[model samples]
Target: MSAAFDYHLVLQSASKLDHALELVWSDGKTSTFHYLWLRDNCPTTLHPDTKERTFDLLSVSADIEPLSFSVDNDRLMIEWSEGDHHSQFSGEWLREHAYAGDLRPANKPRARSWDAQFLKDMGSASFNDLTTDDAALYSWMKQLDQDGIILVKDMPATEQALDDVAHRIDYQRQTNFGVTFEVRSEPNPINLAYTALALPLHTDLPNQETPPGYQFLHCLANDTQGGESVFADGLRVLEDMREQAPEHFELLATVAIPFRFHDETHDIQHHHPMINLDHQGNIVELKYNAHIASVFDLPEAVMHDYYLAYRDLMGRMRQAKYRMQYRLKAGEMVVFDNRRVLHGRTEFEPTGHRHLRGCYVDRTEFQSRLRVLARQHD
Candidate 1:
């Protein structure tokens, strides 16, 4: 047997500095080529990183000049005057750069900073000074969409005010943990007696098949001594995990874990990868609720390893470096992206009173409101 191949030059064009080449097949099909791609992917002393695949052409400046090109028999070569370099393209090179697959869709745009319409909708003062107004509320929602959290101050210290806040955000009062759930210090022998419940840092409704995306808690009364609400940005924790324990991060991103909520009233369970990623595999959300984790059904050999990774992740969650704590005063409400932020509370004295009306809102609704408000400016 013999290794066999056929070669021919189909089309060729050149510029003063850059060139274009096209190759045709026996069936008369054509494929275009750019000299810049060849130069960038050149396997020579000038281009040491052969493995570097550059797909994002948007990053290149418009001022870049094209390189000159030529075809000799089966090989396509490019010559650039900038560095006085030459690159030869092989059949493998053309195949590697060929557009044989579907192009991926563009990434969803994320604002690096709040826009003018967003600020106007949120009210200018609210964006700059956190002032309250109809526009300010709109801006607050935009901020929440961008940062996954927003604080509204000077809200009315009444149940009606809490409901008003919920209504403004278009949040339906979730019945399971409805619009207003009293958070008074209760006596429970099994947990603690006559003391505030030190709620663990976790997202609400982890057991639900479709967990709520946003949570808003308005402080109506806070004459209590302690019970400060702690907020941890789950995305920040994920970044820390990437830097400190990459393997653990990989495990969380790849392994699906079971979460459950079972009681006399309801029994719910679901499985999700601990680190959720967008279509591009970019870290988007982290769901870690040990209390609700029903089981870690890993292979017997890796069971111990899984537990160790879980423990390490929990330790990182507890670190002060990853958490931000602030106590809400009367008439203030804090809303956060429940899917990407963990909330907890410190224990307070039962003698004093602490009350908050909490509610959940779908994140899509919040984002929809923002998009609508953004369009109003246009």
Candidate 2:
């Protein structure tokens, strides 16, 4: 049965307009369907084999009219006066495409933020279970979307194992750092992660033209002291700033900052607001990186205000109420949304081998995998 045939979603009565059908749904809400839309979307016009719209709209006259209309149990049936054509539209279908000014569909998942206390355990999965079980993988992807992070234990402790898991979701996003880079203490480090330093909470690769949306880090060995993983929701912090200090939130939301990554081979630079907003003024991206940030080129007065907002945001990120810290174990991997949440590590002693393999995948591919898996499992 079509979704429109649901008895609960039926329309009580329809008032046919000169150019549209004014519908009063059983639930009290109302909507209108244009005369042209009904003529073009009749079920009889749909190909029987393909069930796709086969009617040619150009064949219909611009001043089309319906000879008569009637409310059936399942649909609003229409008879065109221009021709012996017919149309039947379900009430559910009309509600789905109602032009009621909603920004997005009701079914799409909205990103919700959480602090440390809000989490139980990091969404955990065994490598073996996720690799073979489609249902398990679907759950993992949902967890990733909701939490923006997941931890998988019991990996095979091999390079191929990490690659296998990554490809199952998406392809490798190779950069100057190569397909996959090793994160061990180096004498001459090109990046801060290459050394045993307490990296601050920040987004990854903020200097890229389009920074990596999601990052994966697999702990191969971890016998050193410190180096606990840190996670924080930058958008949640921005929400706090909006309520606590509107001025600070406004400055950060509108001010663009420069981030750069320079090396012998690659010189990547990008300018983005610390808090990015969409047309609806919703936080779409939280691009921040103290490590890669370049000097502000704004006027002295503007820079002063920028720093004040910047420092306050930085301080809020460090607050215990916003952070979630967990130690990574060997054969354990963590995945996170690099654009939404900030990730970092505490300084370790550089004693023993503390190796971590890392890689990146475009968010588009990640979302594609999730949707595919969801359909398959459903």
Worst 10 residues of 1 by lDDT: 115-124
Question: What are the lDDT figures for the candidates, one per model?
Answer: 0.65, 0.80
Displacement of residue 368 (Cα, Å) in model 1 is: 1.4
Window of ten residues with lowest summed lDDT in model 2 = 100-109
Over the stretch 265-326, how does candidate 2's per-residue lDDT look in tens digits? 98888887778777667776788888889877876778988899899998999899999888
lDDT of 1 by residue, 229-295 (tens): 8877777777778888888888778777789888788778888777778877667677777888986
Shift in Å, residue 95, candidate 1: 26
RMSD of each: 15.0, 4.3
